[model samples]
Target: MKGPHRIIIVGGGFGGLRAALELVKRRARLKSFEVTLVDRETRHIYSPLLYEVCTGGLDADMGRASVQELKSGVAVPFSDFERRVKKSRLHFVRGELTGLDEEAKEIALKDGRTLPYDDLILACGGAPNTFGIPGVEEHAFFLKWLPDALRIRARIAAFLEARRKGKERRVCVLIAGGGPTGTESAAELANFFQRMTDAGVLDREAWHVRLVEAGPTVLPNHPEPVRQAARKRLEALGVDVMTGTKLNKIEPGRACLTIADDGEECIREADVVVWAGGIKPPAAWKSLKLPVDAKGWLMAEPSLQLKGKDHVWGLGDAVSFMHPKTGVRVPALAQVATREAAIVAENVTRLLERRPAITWNPPEYWMTVTPLGGHHAIADLGRFVLTGFPGYVARKVADLMYFCSILPWRQALRLWAKGTMVYMRND
Candidate 1:
């Protein structure tokens, strides 16, 4: 508390980045406070558009931005800023964090470096949930990051290319889990295959897209009517929907599943496997001696501060805080992350000013937009749901709105125009 307060934030996801931005904005007002953001990855990925990247509907580069680029955009004055600001001293170390020594207030990195901090924020985000299924970690592809999306795209292209050479001449895609990510990915794959077949690049008879869900219906988080509409839309796109199916195991090229209703076992061969089941907190959090919920998510208060830790805060998918109204844990989504980020920013500001933290109330509009490939989408906005062409337009507009909200108006308009032109040309 004597020298400038050093605030170190781990993970460059939405929560961490937003906190850093807010800290930078308040630099002129504070006399002595330094913020350093750290992450294992070099770039921050927009996780929502990852499915489109995998299906070639959108370029992979469109879904990521370098951490350095993000820093540059914030315009923190280097002269008055902390020395770490010079020569990219933000400690972009690429390694796993081993553990935290609470007594010493230091973070031990895998590379043998210990970073001491006056305050810390954990925004490490979530990992793909494997449900303890065997062979999944080794063989299955996840859509969590840009690399995952790129790998999926490459694998799909390779599969298709191999088919052209009469190698089995059959392609099967099995997408596990039926959340928004899985549903959107399945639709994208169906659309990609349909377009390829229409253009004589792929054979309709040779390609198959299967969506597997353990729940009674796809989009288990959505309302029943919305789920039914999504199912119908997917069916129309030739995606095989297998509901009430629980994955038992995954072999080299096949998946063993048990039907939830009858408990009957079945095996299906797959050329490409995508695991979109769900997400869990990162493995690092499990080893930490901090307070965590039964689900392994960090237990944080409504103010986004970690339980039993005054100097530490948590947010995004890695932290679980119950909703004041619903009493249920808030779902992990970009919108939730954004709202949490603002609250965290204000809380951090208040903490710096020696004032009490403000209460964070959940936003009312928990809307979701799901793309159905080729300028088609489905949207559920709480009270109302829209599908087909109108839904697609709304989805595009919503995407633009999110970008516009975060980015400068000029940049946001450019992205919107570029996206519109690309979609039109592709159509």
Candidate 2:
């Protein structure tokens, strides 16, 4: 009799889910392997559409897919392998993971249950970093998860409704941090306000949007030309772009800031505050006591294996690997995470078969499509950047392509057409 071959995957984000799918696809020969995916949430959210949800461009319902739906699609061999495992063995315990002991190879859940694994893959993604600012956690809203997006949308809607009811009508929204997420969110909110005003759901004079950045300019990492064009577009839409402003504190309805240029302090009052600052790895990664970077991201070798650990791998936003050519750690983006998932999947299969794992290589060009409300967008395709109608079309096509990746071609096409028509009508 042989002991159970257990593989446990933590987190249901892009990388972990992809790894589970790949393993299921190859489960015929690895019938003895049992895989369990553990996630606190029951649904896997398409995080890119979260901005759309916040701005009323899309309903929150459209952003989620049930984990049961994903599990049902597992191949026959994988399903059989899972069924053969005991109830205690097939643990899908729903709770927060408290810690992990690398030496003991045990995971501690909040419910006080410990799970042991023969192999583990940590794809635990990131959480919004508040930087310990006073009153931020009490008042500022984050947009990292599905609930956060919905809460922001609800708060905005409530403010608009209050203004319509002859309230004070001072509904200014101050979004902190002007990265891609912050910029896209500001644009989307502006578009939503404009659309609502046009439809008589809101008053243009009653609502205002302000985008604040600590950097010298918005989107500093992007191409200079692209950044300028985006700034122009945002300004044209009436967004208050404040550059080089450091946030000091966020009170109940006011944000205190220090102007870098003048060293003068200012306070901006708002009905709602959205914090789209940077993200850091989850607490589980830090609790592992592994060799993690200062930001708590697991350090991995070029093969995507965790340092000092064999038969264990990590990827996505939770892991950091050095680039062979540049010797720089790659940014935690969706494209890199997906590519890393594929490489890790292949490497895991090879390891099981006693074959050598291949080295990982980064892509030459990385592209990002950012929506700027009402079919307008920006496409930064490495060498070139496109805006206006061309960029909008590219964004729509890219969204359809994402749907095609997850759904069948026919189903994806129908959904794309229906979604487009609905969006146009809503606008």
Per-residue lDDT tens digits for candidate 2, residues 162-267, read 6657776668899898998899888888877777677776667877899999989988777788789889888877789999998989998889999999999998
In model 2, the runs with Cα more than 4 Å from the true position are: 57-93, 410-427
Runs in model 1 lying further than 4 Å from the true structure: 57-93, 413-427
Alpha-carbon lDDT of model 2:
0.74
Predicted model with the maximum lDDT: 1
What is residue 321's positional error in candidate 2, in angstroms? Answer: 1.9
Q: Write the per-residue lDDT of candidate 1 for residues 161-246, one digit (tens) a residue.
A: 57767786777899999999999889988888888788887778888999999988999888887888899989988999999999
Q: How does residue 422 of candidate 2 score in lDDT? A: 44
Please give the CA lDDT of all the candidate structures: 0.76, 0.74
